[model samples]
Target: MTYDTFQPHPDLASLVKCYWTLEVPPAADSQRQRIVPDGCIEMIFTLGDDIKRYTSADEFIIQPRAMILGQTIEPFFIEPTGYVNAFAVRFYPYGFTSFVTASLHSLANKETPLELLFGDTPAAELEQKIIPATDAKERIQIVEEFLFTKLKSEITIDNIVKSTVGALLETNGVAPIKSILKDDPSKRRQLERKFLNQVGISPKQMGRVIRLQTALKMLLNRQSDSLTSIAYESEYYDQAHFNKDFREFTGINPKEFLGHENMELSSIFYAD
Candidate 1:
C-alpha cells in the first residue's frame, strides 16, 4: 500500500489540511482499518474499486466512489480492494460546510454521496478526473485544481461555524456544549441544530473525539508509561475516564489497542 499527503492551496490551507492519495498493489489485502474522528470532513474520489464500510463482521455498505464522509461519531471498519486508488480532501471542522447548501445535521454519521450535495453530473465529472490520473503526483495536482476551481468559488463559512470549531480545537475536543456557549445558551441549541446539519455530530461529541485523538497519538508514540499519566495529560478526569473515552472511540482499551495489528494501521491517522 502507498499513501501520500499534499498541501492544499494557500487560500484553503485553514479549511483543508491536505489532499491525499492511496494505492495498493493488485492482490494485496488491506486489513480492516479504523479511523477515529478528527473534527473534520473528507471528500473522497475513488480511482478504482469501491470500498466497504462495516459496522461489524457482517453489516456494511459500499461507500460511493465519490462521497463526503462527515464527522464520524463512532469508529467504523474499511475494507478496500487491492489496487485501491483514491484521492481525498481532509477538511478542518469549519471548512467543509462552507460548500453545503443543505442542513449538515442530516449528513452526520452518514456517508453522503457527493452527487447529493453537488449534483450528480458535477460529482461524476470530478470522480472521472481523479481516478484516471497517471500517478499519485498527478492525482494530487488534479484534485487541487478541481477543488481550487470549484470549491473556492462556492466557499462559505458562517460565524457560528467558525466559533464552534474554535471552541472544539481550543479545548482539544473536551469542551462542553454549555461551556462553549456560556455567553448564550441559546446559541448552544442553535449550534447543535447547525452541527447536526453541517457537522453530522453534536458539538459535544466532536469535542470528545478530538480529545481522544490527542491521547491516542501519545500512546502510539510511547510518550507515556501509564494510562493515568496519559489521561491527566489529555485532560480527562482520570485514568478511568481516559479508558472509557478510549473504548468509546476505538472499541478497545489502550493496552490492547497498542498491540493489535489493526491498531497499527489506525495509529497512522490517530497520531498526534
Candidate 2:
C-alpha cells in the first residue's frame, strides 16, 4: 500500500486541507478497513477496481467511481475488490459547503455521485479527464480547474462559524462550544443550526473528532511511548477516557490499532 498527501493551493488553503492518493495492491482475499470521522468532506475518484462500502456487517454498496463522501459521524467498513488506486481531496469541516449549494446536512454519511453536485455533463467531463491523469499532480490540477471555475464569486464560510471553528481547531477541540458562545446565549441556537447546515455535525462532535485526530497523529508518528502520555497530551482526562473515545471512533482500542494488519490502509493515511 502507498499513500501520499499534498498541500492545497495557497488561495484555497483555508478551505481545503489536502489532496491525497492511495494505491493498494491486489489481494486474493480482500480485507475490511474501518474508516472513522475526520470532520471533513472528500471528493474521491477511483481509477482502479470497484470497492464496497459496508453500511452494516453484512450489507454494502459499491462505491461510486467519482463521488463526494460527506461528513461521517461514525466508523464504517469498506473492502476493495482488487487493486485500489484513487485520488481524493479533503476539505475542512465548513469548506465544502462554500463550493456547493446543497445542504451538507443532507449529505451526511452518504456518498453522492459527482453528478448530484455538478451537472451530469460537467461532472462526466471532469471524471473523464481525471480517470486518465498521469499522477497525483495531474489529478489535482484537473480538480482545481473544475473547482476554481465552480466557486461562486461571493462565496465564503460564514464569519461567525468560521471563527468558532478556528478556535476549536486551534485548541485541538478542547475549547468548549459553550465557552465560545458564553458571551451571548442568544445566538447559540442560530450558530448551531448554521453549523449543521455547513459542517454536517454538531460542534461538540467536530471537537471530539478533531481531538481523536490529534491522538491518531501521536499514535502513527510514535510521538509518545505510552497511551497514557498520548491521552494527557491530547487533553483527555485519563487513559480510560482515551481508550473509550478511541474505540468509539475507530471500533478498536489503541494498542490493537497500533500494530494490526487490517489497519495497513488506515495507518498509511494517518502516517501521511
Candidate 3:
C-alpha cells in the first residue's frame, strides 16, 4: 500500500485541505476496510478496479469512478475488487460550498457522481483527464485547474460559518460552538442552517467528527501508552466516553484498530 498527500495551490489553500492519492497493489487476500468521518467533503477519482462501498453488512453500491463523498455521520465499509488506486481532494469543513449550487445536505452520506454536480460533458472530460494522468502530480494539477474554473464568484462562505469552523479547527475540534458564537442566540439558528447547506452537517456534528479525528490520530500515531491515558488527554470525561464515541464513529474498538492489516491505509492517512 502506498499513500501520499500534496499541498494544494496557494490560491485554493483556504478551501482545499490537500490532494491525496492511495494505491494498493492487488493482493491475494484483500480485506474490507472501515472508513470514518472527519467532517470534510472529498472529490475523488478512482483509476483502478471498482470497489464496493457497504451501507450495511448485506448491501452496497459500486463506488463511482469520479464522485464527491459528502460529510459522513457514521462509519462505512469498503472492499476493493482488486488493485485500489485513487486520487482525491480533501476540502475543509466549510470549503466545498464555494464550488457548486447544490445543497451540501443533499449529498451527505453518499457518493454523488461528478456529472451530477458539474454538467455531464465537462465532468466526463475532467474524469478522462484525471484517469489518464501520467502521475499523481499531473492528477493534482488537473483537479486544481477544474476547481479553479468551477469556483463560484458570488457565493463566498458566510463569515459566521468561517469563524466558527476556524475556531473548531484552531482548537483541534474541541471548541464549543456556543462559545464560538459568543452566546449570540439569534445567530445560532442561522449558523445551523448554513452549516447544513454549506458544510453538510450541523455545527455540533462537525465538532464531534473533528474531536474523533484527534483521538484517531493519537491511536494511529502511538502517542500514548493506553486508552485511558489517551481519553484523558483528548478531554473525554472518562475512558468510557472515549470508547463510546470511538465505536460510534469508527465502528471498532481502539485495541482492535491498532496494527491491523486492514487499517493500514487509514492509518497512513491519519498518522500524517
Candidate 4:
C-alpha cells in the first residue's frame, strides 16, 4: 500500500484541505475496510479496479468512478475488487459549498456521482481529463483548474457559517456554538439553518466529529499512554463519554481500532 497527500494551490488553500492519492496492490483475502466520518467532504476518482461500498449487512454497490462523497455521520465499509488506485480532493467542512448549489444536507451519508451535481457534460469532461493523467501532480492541476472555473459562478459560503466552522476547527471542536455566536439565540438558529445547507450537518455534530478526529490522531500516534488521558486532552467529559462518542462515529472502541483488520485503510487516513 502507498498513500500520499499534497498541498493545494495557495488560491484554494483555504477551501481545499489537500489532494490525496492511494494505491494498494491486489490481495487474495482482502477484507472490507470501515470508513468513519471525518467532518469533511470529498471528490473522489477511482483510477483502478471497482470498489464496493457495503450498504447493509450483505448488500453493496460499486462506487462511482467519479463522485462526491458527502458528509457521512456514520461508519461504512468498502472493499477493493482488485488493485486500488484512487485520487481525491479533501475539502474542509465549509469549502465544498462554494462549488455547488445542492444543499449539503441532501448529499449527506452517501456518494453522489459527479454528473448529478455538475451535470453530464461538465462532469464527463472533467472525468475524462482526470482519467488519463500520468501522475498526482497532473491530476491535481486538472482538478484545481476545474474548481477554479466553478468558483467563478458559485456563491461563497455565508460569513456566519464560515466563521463558525473556523471556530470549531480552531478549538479542535471544543468551543461552544452559542459562545461562538456571542450567545445570540437568533444567530444560533440562523447558523443552524445555514449549516445544514452548507456543511451538511448540525453545528454540534460537526464539533463532535472534529473532536473525535483530534483524539483519533492522538490514539493512532500513541501520543498518550492511556485512553483516559487522551479523553482529557480531547476535552471529552470523561473516558466513558469519549468511548461513547468514539463508538458513535467509528462503530468500534478505541482499543480495537488499531488492531482491527478492517480499519487498515482508515488508520492510514487518520494517521496521515
Highest lDDT scorer: 4
Scored by lDDT, model 2 comes in at 0.89
Each model's C-alpha lDDT? 0.77, 0.89, 0.89, 0.94
Residue range 1-272, candidate 3, lDDT tens digits: 88888999999999999999899999888898878888889999989999899878899899989999999999888899998999999998888999999989999999999999999999999998988889999988888999999998765799998898888877877888879989888989999999899999999888888888888898878899799988887888888888999889888888788977667667787776
Q: Write the per-residue lDDT of candidate 1 for residues 232-264, one digit (tens) a residue.
A: 988999888889988888888888888786675
| Comparing 1 and 3 on lDDT, the stronger one | 3
Query: Model 4 compared with the native: what TM-score?
Result: 0.98
Clashes in each model (backbone N, CA, C under 3 Å)?
9, 0, 0, 0
Which residue runs of candidate 2 sit more than 4 Å off their true CA positions?
none
lDDT of 4 by residue, 50-93 (tens): 99999999999999999999999999999999999999999999
Q: For candidate 1, what is the lDDT?
A: 0.77
Worst 10 residues of 3 by lDDT: 259-268
Which pairs, if any, clash in model 4? Answer: none
Q: Arrange candidates by TM-score, descending.
A: 4, 3, 2, 1
Which residue pairs clash within candidate 2? Answer: none
